[model samples]
Target: MKKMISWNVNGLRACMKKGFQEYFEAADADIFCLQETKLQEGQIDLELPGYHQYWNYAEKKGYSGTALFTKEEPISVRHGIGIEEHDTEGRVITAEFPEYFVVTVYTPNSQDELKRLAYRMEWEDAFLSYLKGLEQEKPVIFCGDLNVAATEMDIKNAKANEKNAGFTKEEREKFAVIKEKGFVDSFRMLYPDTVTYSWWSYRFQARQRNAGWRLDYFMVSESLKDAVADAKIHTEILGSDHCPVELDLEV
Candidate 1:
């Protein structure tokens, strides 16, 4: 059995103040994927007893970044998926195990003014292509904060957010391309009618109201569907604006 967990911690430093260590110890996942680390080089010093840590830091301090903690070491590891421009934010880290490659990405968010929408579109296309390229070699288990709500069911206030950054039509269409390229959203597969969520805004006391979006995800190549055990949202765990997503599988 293999277990993987993904979370957008918002800020690594702040999460540490809100029971992060406790959550990490209890998860005991085979591989843990983290996004929005928001740290610079030499900023964080983790001490996980049994996991090998791989971190990709942004060139800018206290900005977008990602990390992975894997109990099993990969045969090879690559950063940024071979794209120079996309690598700037430190968004992706790929670890190739004997059986599969785990790629974690912290997708670029279109800001409030939606100034980055065009760039975000480019990223979606490039990222999908990158994963497809990797699929030629091995089954892929990709996880992270994708930033967009792929479906209307993915957010509490879907209609209200239809024109918003994360639920925009263009963004949603790009995500559809991913599904067409043969990836399965593990969580939705297990519980189709379930309306579980992974992220909430600090404003309007959204978390307390259970008003959130399913921004984080665990996806795998369609060929690996039979290996999926369960996909869950750990909404009970509080710390970041986002909660954690867990995947159980026979890898």
Candidate 2:
């Protein structure tokens, strides 16, 4: 089985201080991924005994970023899907394993009041096209804080936030394109029930109240569905406002 875990630690230093490494070891994923590291080169180095690390650092330190810790080094590693504009945020890391391509992303948020909504919408188009290009070569396993909730069932009070950035019509439609391209959202595929969430707003004591959103996800080319054994959201494991999401694949 190929087990993977992804989390937006908020800040690497902050998360490490709050028992990040302990959970890292406990989860014991073959491919462990992290987002929003918010650091640059030389900021931190992880000593994961059996894993080879790949990091994509934002041009601006302490900003958007991502990393992958893989037990098996990829035959090749690519960043940003060759999109120079998106590369600035260091949001994507693609690792080519023998059987499939694994991509870890920290997609751009539209920001407060949907200020960057236009850019984020453009992002969805470009990103989906990129993933499709990749799938043309091999099956793709894409996981991250996609920053958009694909369905009304994905977040608490979804109707209340219908006009919000992540749940807006444009965003949802773009995500629909992913499904149209034959990618399966693994977690939802396993559990059709609504109200399961991976991220919560820090304010209003959201996590404590279980008032949250399922913004993070794991998706694979539909052809690989049988490889999916399990998908999970570690809402009970807390540190950042967002918890961890995991996937188990027979690949």
User: Tens digits of per-residue lDDT for model 2 on 106-217?
Assistant: 9899887999999987888898899999888999999999988888888788889988878888888888988988999999898988569899898998888888888999
The estimated TM-scores of all candidates read 0.98, 0.98
Please give the range of 10 consecutive residues that has the lowest summed lDDT in model 1.
Answer: 39-48
Off by over 4 Å in 2: none
lDDT of 1: 0.92
In terms of lDDT, which candidate is strongest? 1
lDDT of 1 by residue, 1-251 (tens): 89999999999989999999999999999999999999987777878999999999999889989999999988998989788888988999999998889999999998887899999999999999999999999999999999989898899998889878899998899888988899999999898888988999999999889898999999999988899999989999999999999999986
Computed on alpha carbons, the lDDT of every model, listed in order, comes to 0.92, 0.89
